[model samples]
Target: DHFVVLFPILSRNRFSHILKGLAMSGRQITVMLSYPSDEVGNHLMDLDAMYKANLNPHTDVLSRQEFRKLFGYTFKHPFTGLDYIDLYMDLAVDNNIEVVLANDPLAALSYSKDVLVATIHDRKHLKNLLLNNGGNTIIGLDELATKQGKSGGYNPEFGLLGSNLAGNNRLKLFPRDAEQFCYAVQKKLFEKTGKTVEVLVYGDGAFKDPVGKIWELADPVVAPGFTAGLMGTPNEIKMKYIADNELVGLSQEEAQRQLKQKISQKGTNLLGQNASLGTTPRQLTDLLGTLCDLMSGSGDKGTPIIHIQGYFDNYASE
Candidate 1:
């Protein structure tokens, strides 16, 4: 069996070095390069072509202009970028490179099995796979937490307090559906205070969870824009603005005051016994905000993937 390794275009030099080392050790290597359609426009084009070819029939095919109009006004193409599809297609034709693997899904539409190896990265493609094979229930973070708490019949109130506040106050059984459970909590909070309150939702690895098992909530059941769902453990609050005018006229001090007031009002709505049992502390909102900033920031420092190098070593030693 041939060993395979996936690397980004940025790591071409490193990939070459590794290949040479393997070759010197009297081992054979087959290189399969993948190029991501980093730009939304190229991604849309591939989707459109795939649909036109009857490979994907559910999605509506749109022109480049239509795609821009529907999504946004801006289309950015990196200056130092190369179209890997074109480059590889020509290479395959000239050199007769068999078993070529591609990152773009549209490559399969043009190249034959002898020339192209299809690799799917799109969410819709994955969902379709699950759907075709007797679909599995994708549970969210809230639901998963509720399931974990069900056996013990944990109180929802302790969810609000600090981690140290764990108690055997089995007031009521937690709902199986996390979103429903959270909504029930929200409703109780509103009833107690007679006011509308925003609820912030945050969790990690919602997308990375196994398809057949419980998944994390991507959006809040009640408030979509108002809620924040983030990956990783919560630590520190980050500020997020809904609109430019939300802080345009206000001084920095005034903005901070408004933000805190908003958070407090939301937290107050989730203050009742039932509400507190199901919800977390107000500080979680800030942690979600920080997650968002890290995700949207430029990747000049490094890749998005966080590599905890010594984590396994420390865990094993402990």
Candidate 2:
């Protein structure tokens, strides 16, 4: 079996040394972006519709323009925050990139360009990129198993449940449970009171426990029971709840004052909770550091590095 380790991080103190060693090992690096498969499929269909409709004049030939327009516009989709995974795939094929690095889920979404257009020659970059993180998640089977044993019964207030996966990490929250219902009620209360509704879901050995911490920062609570059903709530209700609770004590005369304050405070809103992770950021940071160490020692067959000038200059100064 090929032993592969993954490291996900912004940058480390020894990043230069690691990069140099990686390059020496003949590993080719590419940046990766990932997206939900369904989202990508929808985008592709939209591209087809736009191309067939000849929606834009900037395109070359009517047919070719259609493809180009679709290709060009693909980057603008906020779902992935990128226009061209295909371009990256093309570049990877031409340059022979081995490993594709991605810093976050957003970056992963950007690299999805290769899912469709990459050719046989594009295989190396795709292989190395996919291999790096074991396809975006490392399932801790041991954790999932432990969680199942610990969850003797569902915690109604926390929406706790066991997952189908093999590890203790698989415990999940039920989207429609009382915890979610109560949180939704709390959000509405915030709208009425104009104070932040702190919904805390505190239960031991359960993932939903983190919802309380999020509630601590929220204006109103809107915790749902299950992960899959989270999108069902209307965005307006969510905002009203958070605004009412988080904004706290805003009379009509002070409405504008509250709005300005919220704007400055980065009042959490419709978009913010979408990427919520139950684990604290520090936990993730440590995991990434470990993964990086594991990946650094992994082998690379033979690929040349074209060092960027700034990177070369930094090393020269060192």
Can you tell me which runs of candidate 1 are displaced by over 4 Å? 6-26, 32-78, 81-99, 102-318
Residue-wise C-alpha lDDT for candidate 1, range 1-318, written one tens digit per residue: 232222112211112222333334442223344322321122212444444445333233333234344434232223325433233223332333222334543333333222111121233453344334444332111221232443644324222111111233222222224555556656786899995444433222123224322222222221112322222222212233322435577887877676665444443244443323434443433444334434533237532533122321211132
> For every model shown, what is its TM-score relative to the native structure?
0.25, 0.18
Error of 2 at 34 (Å): 6.2
Candidate 2 stretches greater than 4 Å from native: 1-47, 50-70, 73-75, 78-318
Q: For candidate 2, lDDT tens digit of each residue in 50-106? A: 456554423222222334554445444333344333433343333433333222322
Prediction-by-prediction clash tally? 10, 40
Clashes of 2: 40
Best by TM-score: 1
> What are the lDDT scores of the predictions, listed in order?
0.32, 0.31
